[model samples]
Target: MPANLTADFLKARNEFRAAKDRHDKLVALEKMLATIPKHKGTDHMQADIKRRIAKLKEETQGKSSHRKGPQLDHIEREGAGQVVLLGPPNSGKSSLLAALTNAHPEVAEYPYSTVLPLPGMMRFEDVPIQLVDLPPMSAEYSESWLYSLVRHADLCLLTLDGSLQAEELANTVEEIILLLEEHHIRLVRRKEITEEEMRVRDVPCRIVLTRGDLGDLASRVEELSDLFPVIVTSPIDRTGLDALREGVFVALDVIRVYTKLPGKPADMVEPYVLPVGSTALDAVRMVHRDFVDRLKYIRVWGSGRFDGQQVPSTHLLADRDIIEIHLS
Candidate 1:
């Protein structure tokens, strides 16, 4: 299929090639992406443009542009899911990351302490969730790669200073929203984006207030609840960290199902994870697509009406459920 390239896109591509500075290059690339037609023929071109835009933004916004920020910025998702941290500078992202995971991202009082995407595994119960501390977002500095990262992420945690007054908190949120909107990113409180959101790139996100011990955060928390689901935390006391971990797991919207041979015990240690509300057939498909053809019926153990009861393939599986399949 022909790309059916537009004249505006051609001009923008030329401008992008001629642009010298990182910021200007990013602008031109975005223009090119916007002008390009969205279709199968242009998918590869769109991806290439996005990749270049991400690399340029990483080099320009991050303080460690001298390093390999461009290549190192794209982190593959691991563990149960990937959750990216979004916030302006001095929002205690590094401190929270250090406290939650073994990864130590430079924790400092100054702004722009973290200049790269730091990945760490955070344990919730027995499951691990990958949490990435990304470069700070502000009106003046924002990595273009950040939007794509969040769009691909299972969840997003927007951290803000809990000590800020009501006005400051509002202003900070406005700044974060404005910057993300500028990149055509929107944050919704839903775990799954609707079909209408595909065009806008709406992402599921929750607000996290760090340093809650700094001031009277109770009132602020109560006020913010009407707007967004908020979680308060303090790195010093480990307060709300557990809740935050659980919250992240919940945001992932996944269920763990253990499978067993007809006569053996279920593999409880490493349960197969699937999206919530997945049916027994869906679970079978995860274990092996071929099972879909051989599967007759699965016997449910946990979370079933009766222990060791047989359930239909369409039966919905809940978290921590165990299944024993009997093939004909």
Candidate 2:
């Protein structure tokens, strides 16, 4: 098989060749690693890039021995799931983050206003999901660490400026997609594991068209909806913000399972979040490892045929279902 290098990879390679300092070389190398195609043909190239990155990191750390501060390369996951925002500059990422989450990231009319990742918790009913606002993705401005954050995110929201004309908006979306692909991140609607796709991270994504109040977005929304679940929102008037929150929760594909004692009322607050299709046995294991072996059966509510109906350990749980573990 041929390596089949992409134009983006070649450009990054050239940047690496032209780099004057270790920092620039490291940045370029990160880009190269991200943009390089993932396949049997490029396996050797990938390994080489990894080796170079490891070496550059050691050198950079050695030179900055006194460097002290929080690490910017990673964000800790919180809430039920972590969702990272990605888009072109001035695409209303900060505005949307401020509107949807408690974090007050700087919202400016100028491009490149955001330089670091800021995270806030967004609540969808009783469940809270972590929403991270990342620096914009562009050829000249995006940081290499942003790609790493996206690769690890539980979900991705690709925001577009709804104020642009449909054609320009579409073009901006295309550019963002190309940049993400160059970095080996694939935005998918669902997790359909396959041999080829497994090589790269397939994070679920939702499209958010911000600045909905600025222009007519019906056409843009309709067109983009064909690609992914689309939500048109505006921080100015808070349009579609509610729907966006709900969409994020649904895109996570997780369910909230409540627990209760046999004689006590169900604990409605702080439900245990689990992936859809999880079983009662899984919940038992989460509660405690001891329960896994000592558990006799589970009584279910909400999804059960009747209230307090006894179910086997393997019984599947649904969202908002209440379970009471009965021990022998």
Candidate 3:
């Protein structure tokens, strides 16, 4: 492994990380495979990339083979957000998902056990963040779906083996990042920088160690904390679960808003609340984008600083505020 070749490998990896779309990832993966020098040092990387390409091809074919499901229709729900869980086999992901939400994914003690993605709605302070438990990444499993999910995820909870050694942990994280990069998903390594400095590059990741009560796992947890937000807990101990839930909400970057109308106060028709970044016009646009253009006046009440204020349709709304729109 020449130093330059190693550098090229890293560069190609980053190119894959920053890729925007599926086509981009495929192109970057091909380039990454081409850039790595065909030597003993890169032999493993080359093989892994070839495997990834083949998997991607299979997925592309699979998509055409199956009819699209109704879930494809985009409908924003009250406080709805999406977070995906990524970890090695038997890292307590199924347990964590069961602990956090109503989702009853099959919990077992084996590798590649979760064959499909399980989505569950989790409530956190008037907001609902959808948590998905994905299949484990292993030598025997395809990493393609995991990569795709991580790229689209608002946040990622990287699970660690509570019984693994420090060197083993490092190696696992390195490989996870490599898969993420190979799929062109951007991630910021928590090591080598400060949290405030971390904001410069927007990579959403948190390190969570399951079964942390094991003696001396603190140091292992500490080691992972250097590169990402680290949370340690055992299912039995139940520590850090609240922090973990809050972290998911923070990652979604949403705020809640309530609805209000005089006589129809209790007539909540649909999506009763919305996320913070949502605009007054967003509501109208959501109903129909044409409403956004025709929106004339908005009467807002409750929950916001400016209660009972009549503002323009473009007025930015705050959490718990009630809004009544009047369109042209």
User: How many residue pairs clash in all the candidates, one count each?
Assistant: 0, 1, 4
> Which RMSD values do the candidates have, in order?
10.0, 10.1, 10.9
Indicate which candidate wins on TM-score. 2
CA shift of 310, model 1, Å: 1.2
lDDT of 3 by residue, 1-328 (tens): 4324556755566556444455666777888888777877556667768986786676556664565663321222223556777888888888888888888999888777887788887777656678888888754565454565666566788887778887788778778777666655556532122222212223478877887667558778777777777787666577678888877766655555545554567233334444445567655555555767777776777534566677766577665566776766
Q: Compose the digit string of candidate 1's lDDT tens values, residues 1-328.
A: 7778888987686566344456767899999989989999778777878887787777677755566435544676678888998899999998999999989899989999888899999988878889999889888877777777876677889899898886788778877877777766777787452323334566678889998767668887876776568999999988899999999888888888888887787788877777787788878877877888888888998867998889998899999999887776
Model 3 score (lDDT)? 0.66
Off by over 4 Å in 2: 1-68
- Tell me the whole-model lDDT of each prediction, alpha carbons only: 0.81, 0.85, 0.66
What is the lDDT for 235 in model 3?
Answer: 63
Clashing pairs in 2: 35-182
Q: Can you rank all candidates by lDDT, best first?
A: 2, 1, 3
Per-candidate TM equals 0.77, 0.79, 0.63
Off by over 4 Å in 1: 1-73
